[model samples]
Target chain A: MGRPLINTLRIALHLLIIRPLLRLLFGVNVVGRENLDGVDRFIMAANHNSHLDIFLLLSALPPGKTAKTHPVAARDYFEKPAWLFGIVQFLLRPIWVDRNNSGLAAIKEMQRRLDDGCSIIIFPEGTRGQAGELQDFRGGVGLIARQNPDIPVVPVYLEGPERAFPKDAAFPLPLWNHITIGPPQLIRGKSREITSALYRHLKTLADEEQAYRQRRQPEPHRPFVAAVIGIDGSGKSTLSRRVIGCFKGESCFVGDGLELFTNGEPHDAQPLTINEVRKWMGRQAKSAKNLARYKMRKLAELLLRDRLLSEVERWYRPDHIFMDGSPLLNMTAWAMLFHEEFFNAEVCSKALDILSGKDDRLKKDPIFEQFPELKALRKLNLNHLHLPDAVIFLDVDPEVSMQRIASRGEAVQAHENTEKLTKLRAAYHLVCDVLEQSRPVCRLSGDKSLEQLTQEAAAFIKKVGSGVDETD
Target chain B: MLDAEPSIYSLIVLVLLSVAQAVSLVSKGRLATPASLPVLWGLFLALAVSEWISFIAALWILAIISFCALREYLSLVDIRLEDRWGILFSYFSIPFMFYLIQIDWYGFFIVAIPVYAFLLMPVCVALGGRSRGIVFSVGALDFGLFFYVSCMGHLCYLAFFSERIAMLMIATVAAADLIHRALRNRPRALRVPLQVVVACVLFTGLAEWSAIPLNHSFALGIIIPLLVCLGRFTLKQIEDDLGIRADRLQPGRGRTIDALKSYLFIAPIVFHYLRWFLKWGAL
Candidate 1:
């Protein structure tokens, strides 16, 4: 009778004073409350990071449920002097355990408590993580969980507690904290399997909490752009559409003239007429002066396109910009069509110098004078050019790309010839080298199914956006 | 009634065994293989203490020893979950068996575990279900009851002998174990003969020194050593069947299986001495 009165008073003190005080001071945010909707009694297995983790978890629970839960604490630490023991017992009602000895006595006591309708909160790592990382769960959790197969094991991940009060700290610092509750995992197998399942479940909750934290924190105001560069038949437009779908209305695609004119629909670019390309080739073959004129006109057009795209990027201030067929890749293909050895370092340096406006030869040429827009584009360089923050380079074999293009029933372009495509494929490597100097480039195999490629691209974008790789 | 005077012969045997263990520890850096030392100490302590205590005290001490040995046995064997209650019951029966010895109820003590526990444990297990491994569980529990409880119950029967002869019986068993330990590594054909000869000579010599009559000494010589040899052989076979290794070299660090076998072997030889003492009083 006396014990019940004391316990009830303790419960009232915890519910009325301690929980509210901790929450008010710490600004505790709890996510995944729906995971605990139907659960009344369960073993809450969590990562051990700080002394305050248990208190934070208790605060997250409803006031009525506190009386039926017990935390399993080490006997060596909790059962010291009379005053400390009374305080620990009143606040937590811990099941004291000796870790050095055989665990049979502790196990029997825990089983008895469970039979009496008390749920348990166990730190499966058995000790606090001194470095603020999760440790592997000990096997005792599995042993107990297996013995009571009917009880649901709810995995909870606690963040910010380690920063608030780390292993040897005397007092907690003021910090905003979070507790993410994951769905219950009911597993039956060997002890190893049970431990593994618990670890993986808790790890997922940690990842989710981390992602939520990143979403809440403010990011720098820089527009992120990703370009999809590949051969015409390498499914670049298909992958671009899928990448756009991954953004889910958070971004816009600045497509080429064909995709823009089609209002974001899939359509083949208007193929270059063979008679026009033959006439141009005949003019080049007639005299060197005609060839020089055609080359200068082509360079001027590329410079104008780069300047216009830069303006489009600034207009979409913070939203991600994904370009479908950029002028940079088209210029590389054009260069490859005329030069057989298009990948030579000398040829690459000359192209980079002309594109970056560092070459005095381009300034002295009459083409810039003929078009004043070309003079305005001289500010475009390798550094300021609208290259992607990261490139998702979809690489496919030439034969496969050609087969896909042939099946599309669209007219072939001047550069879609087998001989030109072989050179263009090699030339895409040099373009990637130039792009690598500016931003991150991720090469993905273009031969995968559409669903596989989308998932991969979505994962890559999420990783980049969150600024932390969850898989690691 | 058993005499209460401290047996000088028992004291002398204890001193001898202690000195031998000390020498072995010094020379070989161990008393015996790590798996045999606990059994050796258990036998030494039981014999050494029972020689000085009252009959009831001696019975209680032996009862506790038998209970611990039974626990060791049950831990090594695979008993079903349902049979745990029966094992607890078997554990409780140890005190009752020794209680019968304390009250001098010899008739009931002899048959209590063998007849009653053997039949009742299977019933306890069967009530759970006729589930998987029923036969194996029943057989293993019965085997544990027979060896650990019934056979070890004979230690309490030693209350019938005078303290001197009772202590002498324990000493002879210890000597037999020592002899087996010494010659365990010899070729099989040579090892048995050597153990038989050495154990016979040692026990006979000790019995004569303890001033037993010649015929009883001769009987003690032959029967005690043969029982020790048989006990060692049975333990080896069981250890092999259970896949327990006995190759550890640290003293006092033995497995449960070795402790079980040692108690099983020594208890019956002590029972035989009781039989002899009852048939012919105090030689």
Candidate 2:
């Protein structure tokens, strides 16, 4: 035994060197470490793999307990190199046991340690097994437990040492050393009964820890938000709904802003759903107040859509959020085209600028002089519009898009004609270029058969989901 | 130097990999998983349109990475309250350093953060009228700038000089790190037990198998693993300082910083070594 000074140095070395190595190198996680509390004279039997099993179990003990809690070391393995054994003796203060002589001296030494009100960690497999598979217990631990029935046997499962430092590896990788200590168990039966009970208890802890690690493994990282954008008749509506339907349990359509454009319940303060945009587009230019009203409605719709997407982001965590239109890309594209057609300044852009706290554009334009109530909507600032992580443009030719629109047997909107659709297609192309600089925009031809388009879009989305740059 | 354009063999391999990954996921009953397919398709598109991904575009991607890493680093790691202005301005160094690289001002870009931004942070901290924790605050700020900004800027600089060398360094280092990770816990088929040595050998062999001239493959093979290990050590220390438990290296803030740490650590060291070797060879 060492003197008081040497004992303090060993504890210091363990605290300074061994702990940090476990921390910085292994990122060791100690669960149920507090379970060691109020327990004395216990045998902690753990399944063994790498050499780290001993230190990992020791390091996890309550502070000042490491010195008192000695590990049982084999004489042949530890005593061969005298210097290594000396260091291990000082650090671990382990009780040396000769395996060649089954004279039961080791059990008596362990009982002596237990009688002194100290604990011991024993790997009852006799020797380290291949990293993962647990070996048959040698019944020696059962003798130690039954001899002292009052002493509890603690079961611990060390998760990651097997992989981090496998038997054959030289350089150890930074694998986590997860230590899970279960509740203490007292076995007071025959030697075989005690051994079998201890093994079952250890196996249960191992299974629980293995199940926990499986749950905590790297979850497939995938982006949630994506937009499907194209011309009016390019099958974006049908394709996006199908896209949302593709995922099994968790998927949603984040509001086609044309219909159901309420961030909340349809109250008086909430504007009516201006489902027909072309009607307002034609009527807004007739009167300045009408244009202000149009801007007010479009701004509310986009802001509410932004609000809906955020609500979905917060409370409802879906696997995939399929946004029907992006205000930044699609609505802004419409605004740019509107400015070219009927007015000098686009309405949605002008209205959103005020929401962004830039009301000078609104005040400078003599159109909003009579309306102060609309300016107050700027208080609920949806300034940062939530753009999708990826965009899939269902690019179709103007004539084909018009034919698709006509095939629906619905009223042709002002911009649904071939000439207007041609200009809008060009406008979408320009917006795609600008948006591509940020997120991926896969331009799939929407003119394909419905099955083909659905298949292609779903594949693009899965690729985006399983595949690229979502980490950034 | 490796070719800037991907080879036919590599392209074929990438395509097969893309399809195989898709098939593997679908077979696992994730028939509707929509996020993974685009990643490989995106990779295919990048390689397919190699000429389209110019220096500016590639550098922007790297800059975005540096920006995200700096944000995560500043948020997670300690930057004292008194060092508010100092830490805030540390973010500006990313764009500033990348801008220098964009203009090809090698002299300014190389020293811009370490020499100049290094001086600026301490002064900024001093000007805040707080003396306590100024050293740690300023020191962390300086290291953060140099680590996230200056190191990433060198990769952009390497790309600007020769995209082939930059791509090879990136591809080889990334491939080696991945292979090393995949071999964890699994029995080593390669005779050597040192995963580091095994990964290095594979890195050099992979370069050779690609039929490209990897002149610094040996040097790169060694430095990448060493720097990556050191980088992980630093991240672990930062975790200690934060007193946070990152038990699993799961995909989130920790993983983002982990990838950035190793990849960024490899970049500046390899860049300077290549520059020095190139100069000596010319002489």
Candidate 3:
């Protein structure tokens, strides 16, 4: 009972205090946590650099695993008579080894610990390096590893700790550090050959970590908004789903047609029927009065959707928000459907005026005076809906879009035909030209495979979100 | 007394050269190949330190250069485990050679590596009682020490001359290299003569500007270009015999052998001229 209580207290302190403190001080990042999965009994050999290396490595372990892990610290340093040593022993539970004496007893102790199902952390370097470089591995680690051939040895690369705390410095400087864990390697042959192999493995891991760090910059903290716009059957929904799948963590999707945006999830929203779309598109504006009313009603519906989305944004502030289709795309589509030439500044202005409820044409009609709710939406200012952080316009050939829509085995809308899609594709390009004046717009070929489109979309989103292009 | 301060003119020339190299590299959209930056940095340090510090500090820099060159040579060739001690001892002899230059003990510096280092390496390897390829190992170590240490040691001996004269000789070698690189793809008949002509013109002009005598300048004009050609040919032969490309010394970079060969070839010429100027006044 007494031993269990002490172990419990030590784990609690490590998880609650020590781990958070190390992360805060060093900004430590661990790259390969998956390699340690299901690995219970193994020796972790790392390059020794600073006093902080052991702590940084320990912090990377999953909670509750620390109780079964032990670090092989030097007897001369950790066994000294001091309060710090006592705390270290209780918290870290290090196994002490004498460097000057023969390592026979230490090897036996390590084997015994491994037999008891406890993993040990050993620095093959045996001592801290001089200038943060990986030094030659001592033969003692190989001897121990060779004795227990069944127990695998995992090589780890500890970077930036020497710069943080050099051998002669009294205190550490605040610097970013990283811990890269490699796959477990089995020891083979004599001690010298094993040591050489382990040294080469550690050097390769360090070089790979250096390249990875250079390629991956810090992600931004501000919330980003991106939208996918394309003609019908241009793989907008598929591309959006794949792009969202790329983000491993928190992201939210908002807008119409949520049913089409399922990234392997069960579709919840009802799919629009062909009859409803045909009825809307076939209701040709017999006169100027009917066309004006139709435009006002569509504009009011877009504004109301924008108002609801703003409420969702306030309720849940996620890292990213992916809209299936924005109000600007819908407005452009409506203009192309009703007017002869939709790719004009006059149409753009008219769409904006109607959405803002500032158009004199809307007030002159009875449809606007009957709905006071539409007038209230005017104060909401749907201008934010027009601008996104990035726009991914998937440009597909009209014949390909028609073939894809036909193959989906669903009710196809009137606009899904090749003739209409060609015009819609042109209007989408015009929309991109206008939107890109204020935001970043990436054009991707939709005729390619699904995997290729997803990769291109994800790359564009990451580039835009990082704020790398100042022109945006 | 020698001017204790570094020559402002030499510093200005080095700065301008660095800026031009930087602009050219940037315009080409290529990085200063790994070997190019280090060679330029080493030359700048040698010139700057010889002008600012006393002769001893400059000799220490040459000692460091010899150590690095020996390291480069060993890395390129294979040495047995038992022969490591002999190779290490050869590396240790570099500082002693520079120390001889420091004390102005020219006689010992000349013989330290050729006689002592050459004899000591074979004995150390023989002490291990391994006779297989013993001759080859001893020969490789002796040649490395002789070429990288003893031959390069002559550059330290040249520090006794006026800084202006030393800088001018180094610049002449650099001019020869530029001419060689610019005309590398031309016919041998056209390339070799043009290299010599450009090198002679640059050397003569710089020597006259530094107030060197006309005869001495003319002799240097003839000797420096010939040495440059010989050094290039020797390095080419070594590369061919070893089946190693020059760029393999540093990946993602052009060949560094040209700069190294220039340093090796200019050392003896500068040393001879220093001896003449000090012992018999200007030639």
Candidate 4:
């Protein structure tokens, strides 16, 4: 009835009703909570992975503050039983509106609540991601947020909810899931403009989740078989196809499946640029202890080779076939997760064994050294995936690369504050510099258009593919 | 009607008291919560309840009411602080002149507040160094105070002059208040049509019996509802010109359209003419 009373009831409902359920079932883990800040109004535009997403979000909230905040719930489910609905409205005070309807009423109600300085949590995906895959998102949250530009919209990823409540099931199953909240990004502008903004926000959250998953997996001592790196908007696909085109042998698209280690349809598997890899590498320390041990894991080779073994039976493992974006670039940079001295000789021997993979010819190719700082490059002479005769590094500025990617029509998320798309572009440029100086690392100028550059690079690759006589 | 021997002291006191009331009003700004029309009617009833003191009390408070009503009019019109003295004489003083008649001072009171105050205010404002065609200041405030003090003052004089005066004022006041209420929120269903019929019959009967002449005035009252309806643009006009809508012009109450028109058009003119005629005959 009154502000204080409503606040008290909200706290009680969360403590007595919601928290216990989350602890009992999901054993919910919340991460990156230091990023949370109190603000007047905003939508928590989280990736909806499970029925557990609601509870996961509840757990992520600092105690007692959910009083003024509401998670938007679909009316069809949250309003079914009168008694349950009363309890939910009493505790959560969720802004329940008909999901089947055009969401105009909910938008109006949300606008009213926002005017009163209230916050709402919106699941941007609008439904659960099935089979551990991030689904394409809907744009209602975008529209409402666009209508009210002052509201900050935060992206939250609730990983592992389908395991808890799979689709078409009446009840939930027991499982553990982590709730990851990305930093808040506000939605501004109208209609298509806002929807594009929401789409970009969702992609960033998905990227953060992918990066988080990569850090959590066990480290292997396997050699760096392949490393794919590119800037935020750089056309990594064309470069990837050209590099793969060089090797006159069977090739399969390894993409990010090897990176994520999940057996599902891969979405947006572009190569990680230097800075993007560094960003992921920056997160590795949070992933585990003995960071050296974590870096050496053969997760990529095993996943890639296995996919090749099982899915592409027609092609035998070629003597020295080139792969595209397979071995994510910048291992020596990722090794920075452990301090420099720790990347020593014994580490190289273990890494070499992993790289050679029990093949004699694969062990003999010259190690590619892209940067002087990368100590592991000295040891990479021992190749795991039949070391390439040479390593070709396409040196593209992140800005040009990003522009190129935009030209290719990929839905890349633009950084919120910058008008010139400089932040993401700058990130791309940093990666290009890191990949600039390696052994046999041919630096291809990346400023040209994707087609022209791809054709020129293809010709260069063909020349290199045939062994030139020492006299000529 | 012009007399030179009244010491002009009477003129000065009426002028000074009107000025003081203006200063008090300008300092008070607009009413935060408007006094309800019912409360205003009750105040009028207090004046009417006693015959001997009624005229004296009405005259005593008439300057205050004119001050108040004109203050409401100026605020509703958004007159500036610099113009208060001019408004006091031009707008409020005219009403006080009529109020002076309760004590048998009529010759100077009849013309000075309305005619001379109207001519002098704009010149005084122009002398003070700002001119924005603020004739509306003189006009609106003049209209407001004249109706309350001059016209209503004459209406009050009728009762003291003749026994018929008391009954007529009571009937007019009661009828006006009732008509406002009936138009605002008539009882649900067909009662509205029935109430309208009764209002029409009662109003027609009362108009014919009243001592004041009303051919042009009552005819204007008849067309007022049509004007108010057509004057839907008044809301925009008020906002454009005055920066505030007049009380009855705000965008609500379709049924009360007729009632507001009557309050705005008829009541003031009838009362003023009555008070003037009663004093003219030395009743």
Clashes (N, CA, C under 3 Å) per candidate: 0, 18, 0, 29
Task: Arrange candidates by lDDT, descending.
Answer: 3, 2, 1, 4
Q: Candidate 3 has what TM-score? A: 0.40
lDDT of 3 by residue, A106-215 (tens): 88888888899999999988888775478888888888888888888999898767655657655564444668889988888887888899999999987764442211
RMSD of 3: 23.2
Per-residue lDDT over A163-200 for candidate 2, one digit per residue giving the tens place of the 0 to 100 score? 65666555454445678899999878899999999889
The DockQ assigned to candidate 2 is 0.01
Docking class of 2: incorrect
Roughly what TM-score does model 1 have, to 2 decimal places? 0.39
A193: Cα error in model 2, Å: 1.3
Task: Give fnat for candidates 1, 2 and onward, in order.
Answer: 0.00, 0.00, 0.00, 0.00
DockQ scores of all models, one per candidate? 0.00, 0.01, 0.01, 0.00
RMSD of 4: 30.3
Residues B91-144 of candidate 3: C-alpha lDDT, one tens digit per residue: 678878888777767778778987888888888878656776677779778877
In angstroms, the error of model 4 at A53 is: 1.2
Q: Where is the poorest 10-residue window by lDDT in model 4 chain A? A: A214-223
- Sorted into a CAPRI-style docking class, model 1 comes out as incorrect
